[model samples]
Target: MSVKEQVCSLSIGIVLFPNVTQLDFTGTYEVFARLPNAQLYLLAQTLEPIRSDGGLTFLPDTTFTQAPALDVLFVPGGPGINGKMEDEKFLEFLKIQGKQARYVTAVCTGSLLLAAAGLLQGYRATTHWLSLDLLEMLGVETVAERVVIDRNRITGSGVTAGIDFGLALAAELFGDAIAQAIQLGIEYNPQPPFNSGSPQTAPAPVLARVTAASQNVQEIRRQIVQRVVTQLQTTNKLNHIYFA
Candidate 1:
């Protein structure tokens, strides 16, 4: 590698909490792992094997307490983040690291945790379509797109959007030539058989059923988001007073 490239090595850390959606991490992991100067770390609360929502288990390379300063802090969303959003220490860790990282990123509902940690205030962001309202509730200007980038905060719309998020970040890091190479390596051209990826195109009946089925989960998310929002507001007020 040339001297210019030699200095490009970056510390990239992805959260690996239990019940995380593996694809949310793995899809991007595959891209970053192959990048010219990316050093990837799987971070979790423990070093034990973390089971993903799909039942796949992966071991963490480092615990949150042991994680190094990261160039990029990536959070992947799943049912798991529901509890982590309420974890004060975890939130504090994210808040500190996110502020320091060059890029604060998330795929799917991971944006919720970032917002809960008070990182998304005044930023235009996106998340899993179902959770966009939850993001708005937390004071974020939600964008309904595959990927939204506002300053250093980048977010993906939903699960499959992780791949796009990864490529976008790849381009940002190594330039279009390198990103194209990575995309070619992964055969990243996507042409789905179904056109129903979003509610706008999905059949009315199908969308209704899916919405109905997820009502309970949505309610739980709303309740939890309300709590987190309150906490964030209180913390911001305290910080204001302290700084004043």
Candidate 2:
């Protein structure tokens, strides 16, 4: 039997944190929630309502400790991911879940969190363009694509890329027909009014404006990523020594 034939039930857990980009989570949610025999859980450290970077609030239905072993472990990224890179407990949670999940996935800068947790070391992944270098510094082979699937590790680019990521993953999991039906159900058509979605497509002046505005945050993210990378390297070295 094929893999899809064997999958009778699916459970997906999406990790939540303060200041996450709500679109990063919700875009995929709209796609995955349509799967047959699937249960979706919004997971967080606690059940408290969390706010997004854009000031939108979301309520998590399950806590990390209480979450079931997931079929798909999803992580979304935003301004809040910088803090998560330094959060040991949160990284540990990802480490555990990522190990057992059938597919380890992320959208936007969520790939950074996966990389920070050591879950993406051998995977070719993608993240928001602004953080692609930071992800590479985390020892992940980075891809500059809308959706990158290397083995069971799937990653998407910036915010709006989540929809494309979702459809791609849906096809992988349930086959193209179901994914297409869902696309029709959701009317997943894209005709952006402006050609400013990516750095490559945006006008030079617009790109410069965005780059200038995010320079400070980028610097801070680089500093934190370096610290996290240092710790990861140290831990790897110790493990290598201990095992050797």
Candidate 3:
């Protein structure tokens, strides 16, 4: 069997948290769900329903403890990532899974969570444009791109880029033909009415308005990243002392 055929039985786990951006997870979910014989898990701390920042609700089907070994470990980002950044249990879970998972992936602010877990420290990653600074503060090499792939780590930038990330990752795992078929099936052609997707392409007033609105949240994220960085540093020191 080819690599594509081998991956047909691959297990994929998507970490879901409260206030997660629905599109960040669902866009990639739609594509991964179409994978032939792939087992996908909506993983969470519990089996409870998770509410998105946009007010949509998703019921997680698997708890972290119940999750099996994953071939792909995916984390999605949203306002919830601030909470996750300092979540020791969640970070430990990622640390354990990430060490063994074949592919460690994230979208939007989710990459920040991966960084907190020490998964992306030396990797070049990207997140929502608004959170790129926070990602960098976590000691990750920040890339301003739609999608960035560094070895086994694949990360995507903000909301809509999840689709692009999904397609690219699918092509990497399966084959170009499979990814093309999936894209066509989803009718993934995008022709936006406005070209204001990026800060560079957006109107000056529009950029100012969004950036202004995001200032407070950005500060909060910065503080969280600081604490996480200190904690990671402390832990590394202790680990080195013990191992030495």
Candidate 4:
């Protein structure tokens, strides 16, 4: 096959879980789906209508068993990541697909799930700003950036960063010309009414309220993170011993 045919025929799989933040995946989908001959797969445990945190529902195209080997594997996060951390089967599935994927990526807290799957081990990654420290505790060198591409493991910070991640992935997969054309088609110009996107830009009262609201989630994630890290460490030790 020619270079163009190879690029066009590649597969892109996006993992769908219960309560995933739709924009985290969709934003990237909007970009990647624009790639020439891109075959996007929505994968889940089953071919059901998976719901998002914001009440949106999406029908998955395939299940774990039916999923094909993907050139790109994407994971998106929301409140769902907390629950998925304990799902051994799903983590195993991720590990299997991720190891074979040309590019393994996540947006928002999705990276935490990747970490739990042992895919982000020793990689520099990023996630939602509020959860950066939590991700760091998972044995990843977490970076604070809109998008981080450490080798083939690309990660994006927060929800909106998914667009940037997609474009970057597209550029890597195809070329800057294709990525730029997609960006132009989407008209992804950002102009927020308020300058409160990040903690540094938000006012004290606004930041305090936001932090307070997420305190419960933070606490719960902290608990899960500790367990996940411990389990991964144990698994690593056992694997080392067995291999030795």
* Alpha-carbon TM-score of each model against the true structure: 0.96, 0.98, 0.97, 0.96
TM-score quality measure for candidate 4 = 0.96
Q: Give per-residue CA lDDT, model 4, range 81-162, as digits (tens).
A: 9889989999999999999998999999999999999899889999998999989998899899999999899999999999
Displacement of residue 109 (Cα, Å) in model 3 is: 0.2
Model-by-model lDDT, in order? Answer: 0.90, 0.94, 0.93, 0.92
Candidate 4 Cα RMSD (Å): 1.7
Full candidate order by lDDT, most accurate first: 2, 3, 4, 1
For candidate 3, give the lDDT.
Answer: 0.93
lDDT for model 4, please: 0.92
| Residues 1-244 of candidate 2: C-alpha lDDT, one tens digit per residue | 7657777999999999999999998999999999888999999999999999999899999999999999999999999998999998999999999999999999999999999999999889999999999999999999999999998999999998888888888888889999999999999888889988899999999999999999999999999999998999999999999999
Evaluated with TM-score, which candidate comes out highest? 2
Residue 123 lDDT, candidate 4, scale 0-100:
97
Where model 2 places Cα greater than 4 Å from the true spot, the runs are none
**Ranking of models by TM-score:** 2, 3, 4, 1
Worst 10 residues of 4 by lDDT: 1-10
